[model samples]
Target chain A: MWDFIVERRSQLLINGFNHVYLVFLAVVFATIIAVAIAILVTRLPKLEPVANAVSAIGLTIPSFALIGLLIPVSKIGDGTAIIAVTFYAVLPILRNAVVGLQGVSPTLLESAKGMGMSEFTSLYKVRIPMAWPVILAGIRVSTQMSMGIAAIAAYVLGPGLGTFIFTGLTGYGGANAFNNVFVATVAIIVLALILDLLLIILGRLTISKGIRVA
Target chain B: MADVATAPNAQADARERTGRKRGPKLDAEQLIELFGIPLIVVVGFVAFAIWRNTATLDSVETNALPWNSIWIQLREHVVLTAVGAMITVVIAVPLGIALTRPGLKRAAPVVVGVANAGQAAPAIGLIVLLAIWFGFGFWTAIVALVLYAVLPVLRNTIVGLQAVDPTLVEAGRGIGMSNLMVLRRIELPLALPVIMSGVRTALVLLVGTAALATFINGGGLGGLLNTGITLFRFPVIVAAAVLIALLALLIEWLGQVLELVFRPKGI
Candidate 1:
């Protein structure tokens, strides 16, 4: 592993960066859409079940299969991979976002309205801020999920550390196969950890102490 | 982590959504909203299939698609899901129960953290790592799948067992029941629903993750998808995807049935 890392340091760095980039992009897309849908669902409670079910059913689509479906349309590489991964990442975040937003007390919103706040203002100032921790949790889940799915995106020639894994599989029984996979796997694990920790720090910095304590 | 906690809650949401036992007849708007999206997807797929009927799809006879090979692959896929889920339950339930015990209370965070890490890391990376270490085959895939699916079960078990009413356990003890008896007779029964929900999640996850087994040289439905991609056979890719999706839904349904069967009296 050490020799492999030393020899492929530059390649590993580039791939690792690519890997994080893919996850970051997917999570960003998922968070934005999920939170938006969550806000919409909160307005129309009857649609909650429909929204949640769609995401749940979406989870049933295998990553490999979804990537295959996208190949012809997205033409592989980053575009197809990112689209498929973003789809999968949407569920956990969307589910959590809906739960978080709905979890905000009705009375609290009513009081904001009582104080002459507009609907959008209450949503922006009261509901979302209060729901930050849970929404952040959703983003964290999306990050972890997309990290794994992004690796599988290698099948479509996606840019990521998965290139090493696929290459190693192709070269199995050779001298460097094990080393290649080992290094890539370790790198992915490390990336996951670092990303998770960063989210923790982000949560601390962004979430107010009142919500943090609660 | 909150994600782990959310697993059971998500399951509950699913159940609540679909398991409305004697609700009023569906209204027009509700009916359209519920079935509309799926109808669009089915229509879209059929349209695309018709539009893309190249000479390859036409000249390629029905037998040319290798149904037997696909079935064999699907069987292996099922094997992967079953073995992975069984191993996960055997290991996670006990470890989870142990963690909730008084003696192990302080160790819960560390243990849960390790379990969370297993899930946090890329599952494809886990499979490839196992393949590298153990060599590629059924066992390697099973091991990787187990690692990836274990977190929900463990976390759910801990949550379930901890959420059990303390007074029930106290009553069991008051009846001269030993710790083991109380746990078996009282705690386990109450926690069973939550634990079972976790198992269901794990099983569904295993089914999906098993698709990656093909990458490790372990044959499964994923092989069909990969082959389809290699050969530019859109039908084959769509077929494999449809089958996998069906299988996932089947397993999730089976899990719900199991939950219903195992559910204690009335809530």
Candidate 2:
């Protein structure tokens, strides 16, 4: 097993990096889009429900199915994988953003408006600051969920730690198949933990102290 | 006529005083509009995919759709996961209750942290390890699914039970109910909705992950997915994807119905 790890270390590293890249890119893209949609919907009463429902339905579709559906439309590989991950990631962030924004005290929002702040300014300065903790929690959940789903993207020939997993399964009778599975499992867990911790730290640093208190 | 006039005026005054008027909690038509269109589109897409896959269905002589094989696969998947979900709830709910005890609060986070690790562990990897140790097939899949599902169930159960009104429990005790009786009659009923939500979430997730069981040749929709991939058959792939998505939606809808049926009156 040790010999196997030493020999396959480079392949594992590349696969691991690919996995991280896909997840990170997806989360970052989804966060921006979700927050934007959340903000827009909050401004329009008629659009809010539409936006919310879209996000909810998006969440219900299985990630694998989403990827599979995309395969024909988009070329299979990292791009399709990233697109599917992004779709999956969007719902959590968007839902949380809406919830977090709505959660802010109406009085505070009115006060900001009374002070003649623009909608954008009030959002960035007050609502988002107040809602940061909840938003971060959503991001944390999305990050973890996406990471796992991204591994399954290997079936589509998408790169990542999933390679080791799929390869191990395919070569089940091979001598080092067990080692590949073990390494991949450990790598996925480690990656998830590290990402989770990083998000926690990011939350602590960015979220207002006042938001943390509640 | 005089009383009616006065009531209308009073209601108008109330509405003027309050920015929002009391009305139905959710607008049913609006909900239908919001959710209905997207659901239709999704369902339509699935139908189109199935129709497109008809030739592939013919190739197999079994409806090119692989119905029997799919059913057999789905049964094995569902049985393993159902048992796993049962185990998860059985173990997790009790552990969750125990963790909420005063003496255990200090250790709760650590225990939950370990469970979170279980959540983070890749399902394929977990299955692989279990297979290595247990020698493949159904038991290994169940063990992995249980580990994957336990944290949500445990956490939600604890949260729901804890959220129950303590005063109510005290009231039950005051009425001469024993500890077990109070828990069984009062706490469980109150916590049922929240606990069911967690179970619903876990169920959906389990169904999704169970597709990975194809890796072990354990059969299910995953086999459909795998065969589709190997044969370069787009129709087969689409068929599998549609079935899996429909299955997920069905489970979600069933859960919603169950929750409604079981929810306490006046809650």
Using DockQ, give the best candidate's number. 1
Q: What is the TM-score of each candidate against the true structure?
A: 0.87, 0.85
Model 2 lDDT per residue over A1-214, tens place: 7788789888888888888889899999989998888887778757755666566555556667777678777767878888888887777777667767777899999999999999889999999898777667667767777777787787788879888877887778788778888888888878877887898788778878764654
Q: What fraction of the true interface contacts does model 1 reproduce?
A: 0.43
Candidate 2 lDDT over B1-267, as tens digits, reads 011111100000111111111132434323553457447657766675567555445554334455567778768767765787799889888988788777897777788667656667766678777777677776777777777777667866776788899999999999999988988999889887767766766676677667777766555677776677677667777767777666666555554455556667757
Tens-digit lDDT track for model 1 on B174-259?
99999999989889998888888778778878888898899888777888787777777667677777666666666665665566
DockQ score for candidate 2: 0.26
Worst 10 residues of 1 chain A by lDDT: A52-61
Give lDDT tens digits, candidate 1, residues A1-214. Answer: 6877888899999999999999898888988998999999999998887776677667666777788777777886889889988988788778777877888999999999999999999998998998888777767666766777888898679989989888888888889888877788778878877887898788889987776764
Interface RMSD value for candidate 1, one decimal? 5.4
Q: Which 10 residues in a row give candidate 1 chain B its minimum summed lDDT?
A: B6-15
TM-score of 2: 0.85
| Best candidate (score: TM-score) | 1
After TM-score superposition, what is the CA distance of residue B185 in candidate 1 from its true location, in Å? 1.4
Stretches of model 2 off by over 4 angstroms after superposition: A209-214, B1-64, B98-107
lDDT of each: 0.75, 0.70
Query: How many clashing pairs in candidate 1?
Result: 0
Task: Give the range where candidate 2 chain B is weakest over 10 consecutive residues by summed lDDT.
Answer: B3-12
